[model samples]
Target: MAPTHSDHHHHNDGKKPPPKLLTLPTILTIGRVAAVPLLVATFYVDSWWGPNATTVIFLAAAITDWLDGYLARKMKQGTAFGAFLDPVADKLMVAATLVLLCTKPFEAGVFGQAPWLLTVPAITIIGREITMSAVREWAASQDGKLSEAIAVNNLGKWKTATQMTALTILLATRDGSLIGEGTLLASGVVLLYISAWLSAWSLVVYMRKIWKVLLM
Candidate 1:
C-alpha cells in the first residue's frame, strides 16, 4: 500500500529536534551513501560485469543526489543532517571513484591508456570540495554563521553535473563499443576538462567570498 503524505510526514516527528534525525533529505543522503558500495562493486565484479553497469548505477546515484535536494526544498523537509551528509556522500563517492579509476587492474582495462590523465580533472573537482568544506567549517566555528548562500554556489552545482556526465560517459566507454570507445571517450574527456576549469574558477570565487568576510 502507498503511504499517505500525513503518515510519512509524522513518521519522524516523534523524535527530538536538535539534529532532526530522519528528514526526507537525510533519507536521500543516506541513499547516496548506500550507493558507494555498489559503485565499487561494479569495477571489481569481473570483466564480464564491468564499468558499463557501474556507470549506470553511478548516474542513478547522482540523480538521487539532485532529486533529494529538490524534494527537500519543495516539501520543506530540509534538515541539518541532510546539509552535513549530502555533500559528504558526494565527496566520498567522487573521491573513491577517482582513486579506483586511476589505479591498476581496474584502471588498465577500464580507462585504457594513460588512466592517470583522468586524475587532472578528478583532483580539480575534489580539491574544490575539500577547500570549500574546510572554509565553511572554519567560518562556522569562528563566527557562527553558516548561511546557505555562503556554502552553496551555482558553479559548484554545474561542476557536479558536468563531472557526473563525464564520468558516466567514460565508464560506459569501458565496454569498448565502437561508438562508446571513439566518440564517447572523446566527449567525456572534453567535458572533464571543462568541468575542471569550472571547478577551479568556482573555488577561487568561494575563497574570495570567505576572505571578504574574514577581513571585515
Candidate 2:
C-alpha cells in the first residue's frame, strides 16, 4: 500500500516530538564545535603530555560528530537548528584538525610528508564548502525558496569518514613513538589526497546541478 503524506507524518509524530533548537543533537553539535579550541591547544601546549591529552579530547569530539547525527535521525529529532549546526560543526572540526595536525611536534611524525602538503586537502574541502554554499544561497535568492543550505552528498560522506579516520590514526601517534608511524602517516597522506580529489569532484557535481537550475 502506498503511504500517504498524512500517514507518514502520523507515524512520525507518535515516535517523537518536534525537535527544539536546544535539543540533544543541537547541543551535541555545539559541543563538537567547541572542541576545536582544545584540539588547537594540543598543538601549542608545548608539552608531551598536553598533546596526548588534547589528541584524546579531539578524538572524542570527532566521534560525537557522527554520534549527534545518528541520534538525531534515530530519535526523529532533526531540527532546523540541528541542520544548521551540523555542517558548521563539521567544518570547524576538519579545519581544526588540519591546523593542529600540521603544527610542530606532530606534523612530520604523523603526516609522513611536509606539513604544508596538508593544506591541499584543507583548501579543497574549504573551497567546495564555500562554493556550494554560495550556489545554494544564490538559488534561494533567485527563487524565493528557503532551501536550507545544500543537502549532504554521498561523496561528502566518504570524504568525512576518510578524513576523520585518518586524523584519528594520526593523532593516536601523538608522542611520535608509536609503531608503524611511517606506515600510518603514509596511509594518512593517501587518505588526505583522496579526500581532496573527492571534494573537488563533488563540487563539480553539485555545481552542475545548480547550473542547470540557474540556466533554466
Candidate 3:
C-alpha cells in the first residue's frame, strides 16, 4: 500500500538529523590543517622570503584558531567534529614547526649551535600535548565527572599564547634579518621554555584532578 502524504511527513520528522560537517567553524579548522604542509614547504625555500612566508602562514593559522572558536560560539555552529579536529590541527602545526626549527639553518642560526636549547622545550611541549590528549581520551570513556575535571583552563590558554608567540618569533628570525638575531632569538627561546613549563604544569594539574578516577 502507498503511504499517505501525512505519513511521509511524519516519517521524515522522526528520522535523526545528519551531523553538520561543513559548517564555517569546521571549514576554518580544516584550513588550519591544510596550512601545515605550506608552513613546512617554506622551510625548504632557502630565500630571504622563506622565513617571512613561514611566519605569515603560521600567524594566519593561529588567528584562524581563535577566529573559528569565537565564530563557533557566536554563530552557534559548533560541532563534535570541529571540537576534535581543532586541537589536532593546532598540535600538528606546532609539532611540525618545532621539528623543522631543530633542523637546517635554524639549528645553528636560531639556537647558536646548541640544538638542545630548542630540543628540550620542543620535546617537553610535544610530550605534554601527547600525554594530555591521551588523558582526555581516557577521561571521555569514563564517568562524566572525569571529563569535567579535565576541562581546559586558563593555564592552557596562556601556554598556547606563549607557544605561538615563540614559534612566530623563531620562524621570522630563521635567517636573522627581521630584528637582529641575538635578542629576538633569545626572546623566543625564553618564551618557549616558559611555554614548556606551563605545559608541564598544566599536565600535572590535569593528572592530579583525574588520578583518583584512574586509581579505581
Candidate 4:
C-alpha cells in the first residue's frame, strides 16, 4: 500500500532536531574557556612541572582556538553563540596569562632585570583587547554596516599568532631551564613587543573603518 503524504510527514516529525547549541565546535570552544582556571592552577604547583604544565595547557588551548574555528566552518555548525564565545575565550585566556606572567616573581629571567619590559607589552595587549571589545560591542549596537566595517583583518591574525607564541615561550622558560634560557626569554620578550605593536595597528585600522559611520 502506498503511504499518503500525511503519513510521510508524520514519520519525519519523529526525527531528532538539528543541534543549535552544545554542538561539537561549541563544546571545543567551551573547553578552551574552561582551561583558563586549570592554567592558573598550574602556577601554584610549586614544583619543576609547574611551568612545563602551564606551557602544555596553554599550547593545547591555543591549538583548540584554531581547531574550533575550522570545525565550525567545515562541519557547518557555526552559530552566533559560538562566534560570541570564541573571541571572549581567547581574550580571557590571553589577558589572564599575561597578568599571571607579569605578576609572578622570578629570580632570573627576561623580566628579572626589568619587570617593566613584560609589564608594558602586557598592558598594551590587554588595553587593546578591552578597547577593541568595546568598539565591537558599540559597532554591533549601531547599524549592521558598522559591524561589517570593523571585521577582523590580517593584522589581527598575525597579532594573535605572535602573541600566543610569545606567551608559550614565556611560560615554558619561566623556570629558566626550557632551552637556551637566556636566548629564549629574550626572543619571547621581543615577540611579545611585536605582538603588542600589531595589536595597536589592528585597533587603529578597525577604528578608522568605523570612524565615518560613527560620525553619522
Instruction: For residue 148, give model 3's deviation from the true position in Å.
Output: 1.6
Task: Quote each prediction's TM-score.
Answer: 0.79, 0.79, 0.88, 0.89
Taking every candidate in turn, the Cα RMSD to the unseen true structure, in Å, is 7.3, 6.7, 3.5, 4.1
Q: Count the backbone clashes (under 3 Å) in each candidate.
A: 0, 0, 0, 0
Tens digit of lDDT per residue, candidate 1, span 50-136?
Answer: 767788778887888888889889988888778789889988888877766655322333346675577788887788778877877
Please report, in order, the local distance difference test score of every candidate based on alpha carbons: 0.76, 0.74, 0.89, 0.89
Model 3 C-alpha lDDT per residue in residues 6-92, reported as the tens digit of each score: 777776896755667889989999999999999989877988888889999999999999999999999999999998999999999
Candidate 2: misplaced stretches above 4 Å?
A: 1-19, 105-115, 144-151
lDDT of 4 at 131: 97
After superposing candidate 3 on the true structure, give the runs of residues whose Cα lies further than 4 Å from its correct spot: 1-7, 10-19, 105-112, 212-216
Deviating ranges (above 4 Å) for candidate 1: 1-20, 104-115, 144-151, 178-180
Which tens-of-lDDT digit does each residue in 1-216 have in candidate 4?
A: 899987777668866555579888889889989999999999678899998899999999899999999999999999889989999999989998999998874554544767577889999999999998898888889889998898779999899999999999989888877658888888888999999999999999998889877777
**Which structure is stronger by TM-score: 2 or 4?**
4
lDDT of 2 by residue, 88-164 (tens): 88888777777676654345644444656767677777777777778766766765433433455798789778877
Candidate 3 vs 4: which has more TM-score? 4
